[model samples]
Target: MEQFYLHLLVLLVLSILLRFLIAPGHAPEEPPLVSSRIPFIGHLIGLARYGNRYYVRLSAQSQLPAITINIFRQKIYLIYSPGLLAAAQRHAKYISFEPFAALAIRRAAGIKGNGPIVSSSSEKGRSSFDKQMKDAVHSVLLGEAMVGITRASVAAIKKSVDDLRSTEVDLLTWCRHVLTMATTDSIYGPMNPYRNREAEAAIWEFDSGLGKLTLNFAQRFIAREAYQAREKLVKRLLEYFEKCGYINASSFVQRRLEVERKAGATLEDIARLETLMVLPLLSNSAPSTFWVLFDIFSRLDLLEEIRKEIVQNALQFKPCDDSMGKPKQMCTLNMNNIRDKCPLLVATWQETLRLRANTASVRFVSKDTKLNDTYLLKANSIVQTPANVLNVDPNIWGPDAHLYNPRRFLDTRASPGAGGDRKRDRKWNGFMTFGASPWTCPGRHFATAQILALVSLLVMKFDISPVAGDWVSPRINHRSMALAISIPAEGLMVNVVTRKEVKGIDWEFQMMEGKA
Candidate 1:
């Protein structure tokens, strides 16, 4: 029996070696291959070791416009050339993003089988449900709809800021709590699920374990926390719907429910779908706010400059009488004017996104087709463009691409001959923080509004300092790859003091029209 087992092992090893030796080589028209040392499993190991950074490294090392990495039987074509990315977007029929979207909805939302959530057919062969959802989101997040949501969000944020009791607090946690409350209250109405602190905490717990959960690993052991959190949050969501939570919610939420119900989704299925919605609405803005704050506050000069910009753009004064019959001053900060008038603040926000965003835009090839009239792509293969690769490319972003320069988006004439006028335009084209069309984030406008409101209020009302004398940027939690936005490994400890200039002054926030 021992000899038989040894013989079987030897035969299996021989088979693997033979397979590697006779592996099919890449065709002349196909993208250049990144050679892997071990057969089948080498690229997977590399990905496991480096995470998304692996693709950026490969793009940097390879001379070709694209490279193909083989993981077991799957072929992932990683496009580095902007022209090829554009070509892929144009040829939307052959290389489709919907299949991947469907897979994500299934895995993350725990929806079983072919549901009506995905459109059956369309001109682009994409999901109609997705298009409806996108339309619904856009309708509610722009024009008058946007104004109403923004007004409500800014008010909620101001109230939370005014209610800050602790001088010293965890900056990330505080942002998450306040922003979660404000955003949810605005979108989900007064019956927001996150109003309960424990429920909000559970949602975050589920978010943290999302990578494992989506992979459908053994949930009882590997992703127990995520599993438990999902159950708790789902139960709450069902209750919210059962209690007619949709009555006062925004049109976006109402339309989503209407579509799902028409598709024969049960209360439980809708509850699961709502959990998916919570990710974009809640998870992204908090960390983005955290990174922006970290970048600005770490540099005192930048912080002071931004504060000045905020005051210049948004601050309005009111005259009043004090308790002792002395003249007193009060200020109201207008959120409507900030996005356009404050270039430095906008630049800081853009730079923070470029530095921290590491997600890839993924698509699956539905049919065999050629990309860029050069490379022949096989059917049923994956195609991807990692934003980190494009954001850090020296060709696209100049020599200082790797560094986090907050003023990158600002038009400074310090170097007149250095393409200063065109830097912002070029950078905008290369930046995929919100992704490209067809698959762009639907709630981007709302997310931007919420983030601006939160950050603007914090910088105006509070003076923040790190607990440690020197500030260290937290590492990105690469394990949470399932998330669209980067999550920090840990929260920052900071001391917050109310700004003296704004002390004893009644403060108010009003949302104005236009961007930001």
Candidate 2:
């Protein structure tokens, strides 16, 4: 034992010397290298043990806008400084996300080689998949198309909530089901595969296994469940497409089908690609909805305040079709008013996302590039910007950066999170949930509408109490950075009681034109 200790001590001393004295010489022109105290595999071990929070610790010690670290000698950069992040985004063409997108999409779909991703491309290198998909999806997520989808999703939320009977239910699990059905209904019409229970289960299983599945190595044995789940979803979706499901689907689905079919992709290939679309539509909203409600309900004062705000601003009483024998009175929830009139609700939603979302925006340096007038990002190097670190940065989001504070938006006294275009988004000025331009999450508006509708309508109509009698947050699954919004490792069962005020009153939702 003593001999082993002596050898390890010598290695430790030698590694420190080499890391400090020698590693700097290798990439002096690039960003300052923050090497590990251990040799060769130190950084990799740190990431495995600490996950992205490792970057937070490194940022604290180094205090650099951007820092470089090695993973098995491969240079990877982490950027946190708001200014530097903005500067890097300005060079989006050079630090392209397309390369990573192309590769990741192919791997996730279990496709081989360079195939057209739902659209024909004029040139290869940085394939047009990301850009083409972005344009098609974003075009419908706003204007009239966005409203149409929002109404459909809102209606689904109503039906789901109406079925509630004050029973014990897993909050996160329930959120996932509600969102899966609602989002899929809006995006895929009535025939969305997720409307079936088996397909719904498969989607979550597939998502849980996405990180391993994307590794694209021995998936049948290693990520067998995820791989199998992907095929399951693809098979169902393939059937949907074969039956001309897009005919009755929203313009969103119709538009994507047009783009993919024009590319001459087989129905199976299009089904595989379409499965990818369901991921973003449902992933963030479900987890994020859980967090926002959890944050509010955990604090009774905030819960009452938000609930009151929604009732006063958005709620309406109206007559509806009879459930049995007589005309029934329905409570209409004006979604636009919920979004525009209820400041506390919107602020809470943003704050919850700020704290819970742990996303890393990764880009492949397509060409050697200079950034912040100091660092040289060499071609083939990897660039990462973890939103979690920036979201909690004390320098940008104020001293209570780590706390859940919705007032940060209402105060009108916060930093712009970065050098933000203040006018574009006044409330969520500092949020990194939806990233910046070029690669900004295209479904952001539609997502916001859905979250606000789901959460506000929920709290307004139901009183949720943890079955344990107190709100104890579940241990978060921090290991998987693939999901931006970190989910609870275990489910939290809560006893949901429909408020006396909402009992026997049918609930409906509307997105009034020019009001939402």
lDDT of 2 by residue, 414-511 (tens): 44445565532333434678876567787888778878888887788888989998899999887766787988889999989989977778777877
Pairs that collide, model 1? 119-127, 119-128
Q: For model 2, give the 10-residue run with minimal summed lDDT.
A: 421-430
The global C-alpha lDDT for each of the candidates, from Candidate 1 onward, is: 0.78, 0.80
Best by TM-score: 2
Q: After best superposition, candidate 2 residue 476: deviation in angstroms?
A: 0.3
Query: After TM-score superposition, what is the CA distance of residue 262 in candidate 2 from its true location, in Å?
Result: 1.8
Q: Which ranges of candidate 1 are over 4 A from the true structure?
A: 1-25, 113-115, 118-126, 321-327, 412-425, 513-516
Task: Give candidate 1's TM-score.
Answer: 0.89
Best by lDDT: 2
Clashing pairs in 2: 336-516
